[model samples]
Target: MVVIKNKCISVSYSDPNFVIVVVAAAAVLLSLCVVPVSAAAAKQELKLRFGRNGEFKILQVADMHYANGKTTPCKDVLPSQVHGCSDLNTTAFLHRIISAEKPHLIVFTGDNIVGLDATDAAKSLNAAFAPATASNIPWVAVLGNHDQESTLSREGIMKHIATLKNSLSQVNPLGAHAIDGFGNYDLEIGGVKGTRFENKSVLNLYFLDSGDYSTVPSIPGYGWIKPSQQFWFERSSAKHRREYMSKPEAQKGPAPGLAYFHIPLPEFASFESTNFTGVRQEGISSASVNSGFFTTLVAAGDVKAVFTGHDHINDFCGELTGIQLCYAGGFGYHAYGKAGWKRRARVVEATLEKTEKGSWGAVKSIKTWKRLDDGHLTAVDGQVLWSKKSSGNRRKKQIPIT
Candidate 1:
């Protein structure tokens, strides 16, 4: 079976010498076999390097609706909707995980910079991508509602993405890019192909740009993709499946095609059915809005997974349009990581697993840590959020960031 994924956070095990122990959820036997692929912590020696052969270690990176025009580290800053996030020191918080996982690639699910009302703040948000981009590591990003400067009455947010895109093009053409500034992008991790980027041969991971202030766009609302994009997405998705996954008849996969987007499509938001199977009429800005976009995605969803964020609390799960719709916790959003879950931010470490039948799936887990005064991840709080249940495929726990 062939496995496909673009941005994956995971632990590597090249050896069998290890131990097994579950954290808090032992009933599920969260503790199982363990191994080490690369043991030392991940760090950047001025310049970053990846594991040879497209192989690398896993690091958890979460959202940081950070205040200030900085990627400075944020530790339990609490959920403050009061604005003025651009001035906060977030470098220490960001470096906490950056220095630890030494991730060759950084996966960001969006919502970090909160440029409430100032153009300078928006510009700062745009420039903030600098420090991370400076690391010379690859990154996969999608915008969240906070990235939506539309309602904030600030055009700076959009301008920031544009500026950041231009700056990245000059330094590392492949490093920075916007999926047409619609909150979509794709990058290769461990050689696995995934994303909504323009690439066709890359296993068809189609991400959407559902605009709005984070929530699924409220139909005729501002900032959301127009109804026209759905057709564009449908055509694109169908074409990708036929082009990549040869066996589209059974919807089985040796070649998997997936989709990701920032906001959740309405069909996937159903709590009662959890069916995640439905088309959207598009209405009401206060509640959740559904869209046919996900249906268009899942028509090919059987061989793929639709991943997203916003409404980040413990994480929402459902299946729609034949795809596994996953709502992983946000990287830095204040409200998503459960009320009491400690640690300031988090990163998703997803492992692409292939079944004996040539089917594809991913085992996702979260890793969290705190930013110390010196600017680095404190190993104390980092913990695994999910692991492969394939019996022997447990992920290796993260090393202490001390």
Candidate 2:
């Protein structure tokens, strides 16, 4: 121990009568350098509020499919076509979106990366989420069909993501449930009503792992959300309801929410609404078996819409019953996409009701659209995708947990 200016600094000496302490000091310095820096713990509850103008925007980038290898000709797509996995242009495209949109939150739907080596996969994901992280925007994700196809397992990929700054990704805890997927969790965005101290959640976001392939012997191709996962969703919803809706002053209703995954559900086949605004070339490549996950959402009455990414060429959205079904275009050049097809992303702008002093109104509506890489923007549906009126309920302020 050494005292300087009334401050004591501890120093370890192997010999009690040591005349020279340089070697010990050097060892201490080396130890300090070798120690790993601890990361900030993940949030237990994420908080979000509307902007000054009562609006929040979310940019959804899907099918990034980044890889660390050199660009190669996708023989499956076309003779003249090339994949953009290792192309520098992929980084430029993502940076442009971050600059243009400046979204409050960026959501990567799935297939954010695909690489052979685990280290390369992590590097690719770091590049993919770089835009959002650099802009100080928190990003969340769900696992897709192609995500686990690489050398990295779903848990391993999520663990890598957790190391990133400003990452809000959460996967299923080990041995918690029978669900076969990772990163299945929900988050809520709260809004405060004036200065009266009455605040509550206005929107909920659900991120689920729509698995890559079916485990059943007979079924092939796409995977479906398992019944255990559905049960997990129900339990989560119930807990949220008990936390907020059970309050004496709480409004009696379901909180409006949105679900994002990789593969489209089988029920998306019934999406024949005439309100389609975007393009759809390939048929919906949904799971072979209807897992009733859509039915679970409908019964829960919280999920207002579902967005997916597996079908790269399909970027259209339409009403499936009362809920909206939408697809974001493939954002990666590495993915299997039409040669001339424009790479695009989906933008969801939520409109919060303008509330008077001392009182708050629910979410007025949510408008969704697609923005192509060329900067062109158009609504997913010509009409409003989801309105408070259409939902038959208004989401009131969720009381802040004091």
Candidate 3:
């Protein structure tokens, strides 16, 4: 018999013992899994808000490339540390960063697992995300080129991810939008309590699936963000703008937006050494065909920055046409990295502005920096991405390169 679902096909032979062994393994795994949260419970718990100190911190974990749990060997590491290095080292780094940063939300910007190396996609995903699930912090993820090379399809991986504890990821948006890919959704961050904009969405977070390899023979590179996804994004952006404008504080202007995806866009190649901050050791591995998504982002007039994680070693943030494009650097020991360079993650903090009466108002500025997985968990390459005070000047600020 042949069975197919989520783009995965399996052929079953007539064997009673086969079913028994599969059932037994599933039972054991299910017993260990955390109970999935109810939709209403998840909605309430995931509603983001700035702290009393008027700050919302986000930790961006990129290219985890985890596989086979603790068994996967470390890549591109020093000889001294190569003895016992494995995927467990990646887990330890995640735990250390989460504990140190204590971010309100964690964003896994793809390559979460090395599907080819992972013996079981489901098991690998569970192990890869155990730190976030165990930490009980709200998190979201998008797909990468490597995540669907296992038994599970891209759709299957996203569906499983949505069911994980404290996960805000969705398979797709609700309604009949006919989106191009799975895991295209937006999250709103509400304003501070007791403020006039309290009920208003002060920030928007957009997630899109920049797909795997190119399907067309003529296009000999990565897949571009489809036109359908662009249309959906435009509609969503307009809807959020209308809602924000309904209130009197619309004069404060539209809420800032930040987008996350797995692959970098073609526009990433436009920056040179003198133009961008941080290091670009490798070439930009972008789609061969330009999809005009960057132009759409500029047209939307709200997205302040875009974050991606395909070219692991190129950890830079550059401004182009009023939007900041950034790479989160490599975070997993299993993924490719420099020999002596420590693994790192990016931290983004958005602070609310102070009102005339000395209370928190809308978001004043968005700043970001990276933390290395060294002894002190050192922070480096700090810079402001966007600020309402400098809204008029869209030129790139000259930050010293690290």
Candidate 4:
């Protein structure tokens, strides 16, 4: 800490016992140098903290509510007419997130199109993905309750996903993947340099689909993850973490691997949506609450942070057990929204950066961007909340209290 007042400038350091004052008549600055840890210390805990320098970027966009099949002769697409967001003013914002962030992976966390309308969620998804396609960035997407429960059928859903993939082909030859079973998909990111260290590293990302299971299948109103998919999800999620370990490039971290999903997990779910990890979280999910299915997945080892969207409200990121749950504020249908001078009802631009060494860091950022309002690509006010990393904290902590 530094203080300058009546007659002095003081400098203080938070070491075992250290508070020193350095006076500078000509203006002097003190820099705190964090000593690098020894290799042995590094091995004990992997240090992963938020840093500007990183190898790749993973951008998550939620609830675009594109009016796919409907024709909006004028401007607004009424929710009463389609019960979905109009994607108004969001296209440019989406493009801006891509253009400025240049993320390596993009995850659309469901509610992609206002599925209630005749407009195909697939076409709306295409429009939403236009910027990603243009940037040649790879992406993996999952569906929301609105997507599964909408007028579209199972076949319709499959067709919609396929349609989006087809359109993406024009941009990326590797194309897109719809994440089999539990909306669970994996990708690897490498070539990141450690901020403090000299070695380059990589990151493995997974999108866990804790599909909406609130509504009963018999009711025929919402998307359910289904038992079979839940079964496969458990088996496969574990498989991914094990597979991640084999990768020589995978950063040193927890084995569960990093994942993003729509809808909150059992532990994070509210009472009404609570199921521990069993049928509630897994029903269309798996009965995930206190059940074995949810336990087994978190136990996989490499699981670091789980970013999600479904609350359709604020951009929240909190720690659940060892895993971090990040909610990218509502990106669609802010019907009762007002931009608080800062535009609180806006989109969130999140990033997971890996330092020179193999440490992982997460950042929650807000942007009051208006290409039509303002032209620069900078994030609003230029401030963010970043996670702190120890000397070698690789986020390798095992999960599940049981």
Candidate 5:
């Protein structure tokens, strides 16, 4: 007698194990259709490299505001005043940026996740870094005011983040400087071959945590960098200069570096006074207390640019004392941002060039611009924001003299 079961037709009495044979055949066919996951499923680290043309592009994704589990409906979000009621599609948005820009390194400036338990927050953060790791790109981040709001402390959150493959954050080991926050660190990006700046780091990247809401009643808005952290920055920059640029008389300038943090500094107020460019829709939501961090940066003369996230609606770049201060705009649907303003990010492009005065290799010019999620682009302040020439030298090459 003939029998049919699902897709297999066989003789019912032909053999006792005829049914088993049909099942086995089906298993084999099923295995053929199953897709094997990529080896990247096992976490891996990637070494960051400069571009072939000695250019390095950094994609800054700010205020991701990723929330764990299903996205909260816009109307259900708390306070009833929050903007952008759409669902928080964090991974999809990040994937789009990673695929389009193909940045060598991605910097999450702040507020990566909000309003979730530690486990969910960790998973949310892991999703943020997944785009970088799967593409073999190195990424780093700093904490925003809301990062530790719900169930995680800054230290607790950072411990989980450090486990992510290709992440550059670590538990602060600088003794006293480790206080209050985590991931206060610096990195050096070396130059490439055939480039004028082959031997040394053409650029330095500084990462610092701009802490959450003030625990003190006297202080307002958000937290500020403590004196100890500023001391660390001064010491670190001085050490880098003394070791790399100062010793070699031929190498004329301090290695050009940029600082990344979550909140804006009080000095960001200077942008209002000066004839600044870019969209300054909202007022600067900086710390009430001036930490003098900006003064230290100006004195060190190494950090020529600073990028921040936090004020989600404002995406602008302005010059202050020859240094370029800019915002990475807001990219999260969970966070409060203007409804009309499209989600956006900041792209910083740096090139190593031969300096006529100092050592042949130094960051020539840093040009930054904004990119909206819909593919529209806006140059900083209506023009391409360019960095000043190497001012670490005494030569008269017309670099912005900060």
Candidate 6:
């Protein structure tokens, strides 16, 4: 007989069930041991909130194009530096920028690896994102055209990214929405802690997978954001808006939103050199078919800016109908770039409004600037994308590129 006393399993010498009870008790103990490990993982989830100084900074690193670790040769680098330049140069730049800016969030806005050159997609992705992971900062990513030319499909790539340390990138949003793309998700930045609006989502970030090649024979360029993806976005945006407005302690209007994707929309071609801040060296490489994603954004009336990457050399920010469209210049040495032009990344800073009682409130202004990978890590073309004080008039704060 097996006797249970004070949570102890006492087995008799003659009992045939002794071994079975012992095995069952071992299984129960093993399951109890697993609970703390699962709880630890749950506790590791990142929560983004404003600092005491009321600022949240985001660093946009785009088109890394990393491949095969240190073996891949760099393109379009100066002749003097070409002897040893490789993907490691890109990694070094990431480390340098992260050190200099110390951003709250790092966004890898796609083409993270050149899939064709990557013999092992997982290894390349690990090296490509090592900086963000090592820094212990929250990071997220979208996908680009060339990311699935290797061992993994687009869905596989997103799933791999979602497993990396400090990665906030999701395979897709949960629920029965049936979104069209892989990395279609959003992250909310909460207000200052200990404030009345601490739990409130003050800033919203939308990430979409602007897909690879066109499926339709007639529409020739890159793939556009699908209708279902747009529908998901609209629903998500509306939900955020409703939550913000319903709160008693919420500020006057809807919280500002920013979007990140891999490919530029067709509307990017509409900006002239005179209207935008940075240089557009290449043609707008948007999909042939205008998928009306820009129209969806404008209609939503919450997203203040959209950041994209596919055109490596075009690092410009232009406004159309109250929405700013911007590009994060190519950040990797493995990707094609101008020999003389320095690789760059974009930095966005959102400042919270100060209440009458001197505490932080909703987002007051959204500003952006570009940082070149030169020796100085030069900051250029600082501009205000949006401002509550301006009353819809976005003022340009230009810092000339030296």
**lDDT: which candidate is best?**
6
Q: Give lDDT tens digits, candidate 6, residues 159-190.
A: 99988998888776553234466888788888
Q: How would you encode candidate 2's per-residue C-alpha lDDT over 1-402 as one tens digit per residue? A: 000011111233223233334564444334321122223322534456666566777888898877663552231234444444343455667788777777888889888876542236677777777777787787888877666656677788877776677777766532332344777766676665352213556777888888877766666678777654565576566655554575544757766788888899987676453556567788889887777788888888777888999889888777766788889888876777786666778888777665565244556788776666554432233235678766622232221211
> How many backbone clashes does every candidate have?
42, 7, 0, 52, 2, 0
lDDT of each residue in 276-360, candidate 4, tens digit only: 2111212222133322334544565444555555654444444445554455545543222223311112222334444355555
Give the TM-score of each candidate: 0.53, 0.79, 0.87, 0.56, 0.76, 0.87
Model 1 TM-score is 0.53
Question: What are the per-residue Cα lDDT tens digits for candidate 1 across 326-381?
Answer: 55444552323443343333333344445455543332322223232233433433
Off by over 4 Å in 1: 1-63, 69-89, 117-119, 148-181, 184-204, 213-226, 245-254, 271-288, 316-322, 333-340, 343-402
Query: How well is each residue in 306-342 modelled by candidate 3, as lDDT tens digits?
Result: 9999888989999998899999999999999999988
Worst ten in a row by lDDT for model 5: 1-10
Model 5: per-residue Cα lDDT over 252-325, one tens digit each = 66777899999999877776633554577788999887767888898998887899999888777766776767
Alpha-carbon RMSD to native, per candidate: 16.0, 15.4, 11.0, 20.0, 19.9, 13.9
Winner by TM-score: 6
Candidate 6: worst-modelled 10 consecutive residues by lDDT: 1-10
Local lDDT at 78 for model 3: 96
Model 3 misses residue 138 by how many Å? 0.6
Better of 5 and 6 by lDDT: 6
lDDT-wise, the better of 1 and 3 is 3
Error of 6 at 238 (Å): 0.4
What shift in Å separates residue 318 of candidate 5 from its native position after superposition? Answer: 1.2
Evaluated against the true structure, the overall lDDT of model 2 is: 0.66
Question: Which pairs clash inside model 3?
Answer: none
Give the candidate order by descending lDDT.
6, 3, 2, 5, 4, 1
lDDT of each: 0.39, 0.66, 0.81, 0.41, 0.65, 0.83
